[model samples]
Target: MAKPPARLAASPASVTPPLGAKPVPFLAAVGLGLALRFLVPIPAGITVQAWTLLSIFVSTIAGLVLEPLPVGAWAFLSVSTAIATKTLTFPAAFCAFTNDVIWLIVVSFFFARGFEKTGLGQRVATLFVKLFGKSTLGLAYGLSVAEALIAPAMPSTTARAGGIFMPIINSLSLSAGSKPNDPSRKKLGAFLVQSQLQGSVNSSAMFLTAAAQNLLCMKLAAEMGASIVPALCGLLLTPLLMYKLFPPEIKDTPEAPKLADERLVAMGPMSRDERIMLGTMAAAVCLWVAGDMLGISAVTTAMLGLCVLLGSGVLQWRECLAYPAAWDTLFWFAVLVGMSGQLNNLGVITHFASQVGNQLVAANLGWPAVFGLLNVAYYALHYMFASQTAHVGALYSAFLAMMLATGVPPVIAALSLGFMSNLFGSITHFGSGQAAVYYGAGYLTLKEVFSYGALMSVVNLTLWGVVGGAWWKVLGLF
Candidate 1:
């Protein structure tokens, strides 16, 4: 396993990884999965389902083991195997590129790049620091609030949090006295980093527009004939109600980092790039929100945004062309969505759902009991997820099928899974993209990360399980 970085300064000087490390764990997982599927006696029609689940599990385990491979690389390997094995055809695998949600993410990436290049994101962060950096708790609250407010408008969490706020978090840690090997300083840094991760993960679940995965959930639910709006309110309100669950001390020792605040502020007045990109993004969002009424797909709105971005020179062709995340995202997402289509095509999802549904019904569990049990199962299932997309792609279908078989409304099931995806990511340091970003920063030790993640798990599970469930029932979703 690669050693975790000792502090933020230890990050590779460049964004790319050094040469000679093994490809990411996703590759190994795919290889092993393919080998197992080929050599094992699993049913022919069910082979894809087995391999998909195992690949996800192996990649996640590899992440926790501290493997040096990039997360996206692992995702690629898994998708490749599914294609090579003929479990999913190339056209089907490549279809995720055309997914409305994927296009939305791609367009958002361009906007985030503009934010970074034009200094708009920095100015926003600095403005927040000025407003809330007076105390430690205030800084924590500021970071969390900043992410929550921005999340609704940003489709890609990595682009929004990683691209925009990651540097800010790094600078904030330095300001908080997070020096290399200083236990006290490191502890502070860990708390702040985890705070930001949790805040982003939790708050992003609130709105349909908050995260791409949430949209995937809604889209999937729509395909299944369930409503998603009811679930949205639960995710939004539960996080606010659970704010007190985090350790109380993040608020105690407040002190703003003067240097970071000034640097962020000094970047000053929006540039041409910022205005054009921001305006384009805002316009795209307004169109997306009104898409249902206008009878246009959200993907069409995103493509419209992409066209303006490319045609207007807000971002050069080179800059727009340079983003590999879109391709990487499409590669894996395509495979999984394809695999899902296959499973549904083969009636495998329906079968699995029927089996699980029968078990629940036989046990005579009521709706609340069923909800609790399924969520617990969903939470445990995160031990197998390194990527949120991988989790949603691999598990949501099966869970939804079972929920439908059990007579649970599709909206309730979809919303529960949506909230669970974010909550489960809070269970470990490498549980989601944002968590990995913080973990890679190196201010937090493995033990510290685990401790904080586990602490937040209690709060998240309780809030979502108890309050979220009640909210669902009160809203007549149950």
Candidate 2:
């Protein structure tokens, strides 16, 4: 037999060979999981069928966290395994894509493609720059306003923040005589970069169609039969509060406004494409906001808007596929939603909730008190998570289930968890999908982003808990 190459003593300790998995960590995780599965006793009414399904769900979730493969791949594996093991029929396994909410996400992404392909997103951002780009702070607010304006039409926060806004903001920074790693960075670039990143989070939280994860949370909430109305109040209040709390140290700047004005003059009037897109966007938002009363679902409204954009020749079929984020989101998100729905069907959510519920009852906790604790803990836990989608996948269903089991209103639990998913995005530099784009600009240091994020997280959460509670009380969320 040919002699096997000797495995080099695994480095001088911490370092390991590249281009492969870390066997120790992967083995540890899988072994720990196996131990839990075979050793732990099952409770009454929770069958081995439930156990198998839960194991598949958890293993895929671990695959998500460890990231041994891409998230979409893991999601695919979750569904495929469920079918292969007969834990779910083929129809049930693939049923998530057929969900109305899943279509809402897909159609929302098509709108995003329209926004990008039509140059409407850039045109709108420039208008904000022209109007409010008078001072550095004004420019900041303008960018915030621009983001919020386009948020309803674009569901991917990364697409909105990274693809649409970052290019504009980057140029603004360069034009204002600011360069990355240069001493002049703090003059205008640093402040704008940080403010806009925060603003992106605000906008993402504000609209249901603002972020991919937001749609995912909504779909999961709907699966649990929960309404998302309470989230609206928190979303509405985030932008202004972020501006007030995280004000730039360099408050006044004449250069930013001048630069914005020059850019506006160069761009000239809105093109035919921009005008049509604006009208289409307005119609979509009107229908979305009035959906419940009109008996027209949000998904229907989005599809209608997308069709007009395509039919009007403003957006082409090839252009829709060209935007990779939209397609990537549609595929991965559909699978995740399906897996979540399957787990719920298998009694996984109820079983997990009952376990947590028993602990709360044993501790003599009331709903109001527990509610506050849960929200705070949920927000704080973001420190341990890097991806909002991963965080939602792991905790949202369980947390919502536990809250529901505790006699909390489904709306209260659903909206709090849903909004908090975005709120937590403000707590770390790596908190959300778009965090890296802003952080990589080299304007703000990691420590600055983290500290500022932490401070503002508390502020936003308090605003929601205190002011939002009052708003909800007035609206009878109680």
On lDDT, the candidate that comes out on top is 2
Residue 429's lDDT within candidate 1 is 51
Tens digits of per-residue lDDT for model 2 on 106-129?
555566455555666555555555
Clashes of 2: 0
lDDT per prediction? 0.59, 0.64
For candidate 2, the per-residue lDDT at 68 reads 55
Query: For each candidate, how many residue pairs have backbone atoms clashing (under 3 Å)?
Result: 7, 0
Deviating ranges (above 4 Å) for candidate 1:
1-69, 135-137, 146-197, 200-270, 295-303, 306-312, 324-327, 330-350, 365-368, 378-458, 468-478
The best candidate by TM-score is 1
Q: Cα RMSD to native, each candidate?
A: 8.7, 9.4
